[model samples]
Target: MSLQFIKRIFTSGVFLISANVMLSVTSAHAAVNIQQWQTSVGSEVYFVENHDLPILDISVNFPAGSARDTADKSGLASITRYLMTLGAAGMTDEVIANKFADIGAVLGGSFDTDRAALSLRTLSSERERLQALGLFANILQKPDFPESVLAREKARIISGLEESSTQPESISNKAFMSALYGKHPYSLDESGEIDTVAKIKKEDLQAFYQQFYSAKGAVIAIIGDLTREQAQQVAELVSVGLPTTPAPAPIASVPAKNQAKEQRIAHPASQSHILLGHTGIKRNDPDLFPLYVGNYILGGGGFVSRLTEEVREKRGLVYSVYSYFMPMAEAGPFQIGLQTKKDQAEAALALVHETLEKFLNNGVTEAELKAAKSNIIGGFPMRIDSNKKILDYLNVIGFYKLPLNYLDEYNKKVENVTAAQIKDAFNRRLKHDHFVTVIVGDPKAE
Candidate 1:
């Protein structure tokens, strides 16, 4: 059938179902059966077959995040990804959107410090599935990087940067990352700077795509109404035509900070934005479970957390205060952030430090540990309760080379964490004296 006919049917809602019903059908069970393989062109494929719903989700990831860009072209990776689907293989962005809309398929992607991902959610029927896959494959392998689109996107990004420069929250975040990472690529904004983005050319995008979007480094995650054999076929179809270049080098190690440092940027805003952090653990760290559980009690558990109880509930220094460990390809930051009146920023920050140090020195109580585990394990099902969530896990697993049974053992890992383990892990992983702090709208700023 022609795409026009499909578009008419789709618009008429003939092929649509209630999203809640579909999600209920795909709710994860006690364990997920993940099958793994490699395409002929060397892309690693992870598959989970669930015939309950007539929907399919696929995520294709490459090690082409902003970290791949050089200092001179710091926004190269981001712009390359942004412009990829805008015009590929003689198709305009409008055509691409219309084609996906015709079959009720969604094409989306994500970029971060470690990976760039392209994803598709479509009906599992052969016609819709194959058509969507064809367009996706073409965009992956044959992006034209049209000069007009490149120029337009560059202008859009540069304008955003200019606007963000005046915003105190944005200013604080940029300064915090720069302070925490120093010379590392993680310090670079995912949205390239105005100057760097303006200098990015079509040739730069082509080179970046060719070097990093290669089959050798691709991770394809497929989950839905398909057999293992069919999943293999789908993987081969999407990956076979990608660039054959070898995998790029690993991201450089994050440097350590030996002393605590702080930066105060003056802004005209009424409240101060404070972010303080140090390097934390990687995705596959041995202490991950302990740290994860510990962090929940320390600050991640919403109003029930120690940070909130001490900083917000009791003293009213701020409305909210929180902390989290962002585990990445390397040790991502363990960040604590809060906002308060400009005059109260120092008091809020001092309390945050005291809370953290007390937690580190004394460790969590048995009650706190139990509550954290109970909360974590109770919510475990939601983590995989839908195909999209499972697809996300598949991407992380494949990209980080995590164990195949990671999900199967997720609750078990959380359950096994103990008060002692939390204490040891936090003490070893975070330092009380080596934090990098950035405060914007500081009252004391000259």
Candidate 2:
């Protein structure tokens, strides 16, 4: 916000210094007052001090991800992620929950192919925030993995997995990932298979925790009413307490596409579950901005998107049809998927393919480019509307080592992106024929 905007807010009788307004301003400046440090015991830390609100958000990630899980014990990382805060270092699950409740804090986490993260959001009222953060730090740095809690969380997790197995979407996703990744560890679903989850033991969790929770692989991001010293303390608070050393990074390669082929799986469902994509752009690809804007014109945006207008509005091929590419460490998959009646599956699929093929050839129209630009540039402010959202952007920026003026230059970049650029970039990189298409449903049998 400019001084004039603040003046206008003041003139309108809004608090001359509302905490939310202050946070928005600080994030807009995007200089992040980011402080850096290392803990005495060897933890790397990143900090941003904002005295705007009485709220603190802290998140830490380590390499304790599925890539590190043993092949036979694929789900162990996921189970460990859930069980950490369930009980840790002399604290029972009930006691842990009660302690957090007493202080009005929440703790949670998830493990994915690349990393595992634990996070907490709490009121920055001195003692409550400290108490909550301390407990979270202990769990990450020294989880007890108590036997009973592990047993219970595993059982609950297994139950959910079994239920998921019956869903067509889950089946299609499993097949899609397995087919796309081939023999790579990335193919293993983070939730793991049923037998794998069953084999997870308390000791496994402890060993995995010990190896991957080091500060060397950790990234901590925080936004709140904390001083630079306080934020560093909080970052060091989480990981320096852990055994220090970096886990060996994984050796993985992007899978190649076996495009122009169709594989069908038999399933008992009303509508076929459809998934399609080849490898997509990597997280740090230079083509990021151009391709992103191009994709919005293609599918990522709803209703106004070419995919929706052609597949849904013109032909009524399916209730909803969409496409997206998840940029990851390597080229991720670009997928276009939807479902119609069993008999209409082929017809719907045909229309989707035709629309995409046309898009690949002609690219987006001039009107489409104008609208996409307008919608994208118009709503860019919401990208950093909240501290939490800004933290997400900062995480990406920090992890990807993007330019400090990324947000400031956002609009200029969008404005400079022409229809010709979108077309050229999409055509150069997007090989639709390279993607594998997987359909799971008894369309023929039905």
Candidate 3:
């Protein structure tokens, strides 16, 4: 789904990895060695050589996502990345699509808050790999951002945006983010408003792409059946043509909002969608493991989480409820989201607040901590079982500048987190009085 260009880029296939092997290797973080180096073109490259299969996966990440968009040009980054594959070096989008298909290679991309990326997976054979990489290079460096294609895509996206605006969940999410982030860049909707997107000209996209998608601003994550030398070559081939400039400055921090803000919008929907939270930790925060484990205990653990237990099982307020902290380049959101019958909206909201307060004050019980650690540690192997998953972690590590041994240290880190650590981490980072809450739906008649 991150690859927004085409819905079906590759056939439905999972890169099979041995779950048992992964489970057994939990003690060793060096299960797969990650080689890191800078390319000739200034791109930071992270390579993991896996010859288990004749598959090659490479992801090129740029600090050019929605966060980089100006207040008025909210969707420009996403639009630019989407259009890159449409036309490059005068080849139309159809020609590019056909080229990949003919080679049995897949080209895809994703756009998010802190980054945009283009990814490819292809057979490791020289013929196929070269063909795919060649096309990828052109898209990365020589994107035409053709005027006609721009117009078409803009219209398509605008239509989708217009449709989404009518949906309650969409409305709720937008309102929630706007309230949470205030005027910070993170507040902008991932997709721009219809008016803003309509104003995004080819010139706008070109300017944004040129400044933000350069080699210095990128990270190349390569995983598969390739040698270190080949990975170096692959990294260079894709980035060498990019403008060699200094990396841009880090994004501004989310302005602190010490006051609790609540936005209520009436909708005809039968269920109320409620979301609440505040600015959370950054990717590299020292408390990352503690927060991760704590969140799993709080609400991220699904069926076993405190939220699910109190909100759903004890009171049956909602069918499903969850919470998570998204640690990005800067502090991302720590959010709890749920939907319940319109009549019970207020009760559900109160219960959520009460439970969070109690957990924040008392922290998790020893039994709860043990359960969370067990679940997290037991499930850790599945996270790195596949090359694609490993590639994703590598991309994040390179982009966020995480420690190279992060994967190896993951299980141990979770295991080492004590109940006091979780409680202390949450107490320090989370402020109950300063959170933003948004509810969308008509309240039931009392």
- Candidate 1 lDDT, 30-64, residue by residue in tens: 48988877766778888899998999999999999
> TM-score for each prediction?
0.93, 0.88, 0.93
lDDT of 3 at 414: 87
Look at candidate 2 and give me any clashing residue pairs.
Answer: 280-332
Assess candidate 2 and give its TM-score to the true structure: 0.88
lDDT of 2 at 298: 80
| Model 3 / residue 27 / CA error / Å | 16
Against the hidden true structure, what lDDT does model 3 obtain? 0.87
Instruction: Give the per-residue lDDT of model 2 (tens digit) for 105-151.
Output: 98866567776778888998766876787788778766788888778
Clashes of 3: 1
Clashing residue pairs, backbone N/CA/C < 3 A, model 3: 29-408
Full ranking by lDDT: 1, 3, 2
Kindly list the per-residue Cα lDDT of model 3 for residues 44-94, writing each as its tens digit. 888898899999999999999899998888899999999998999789999
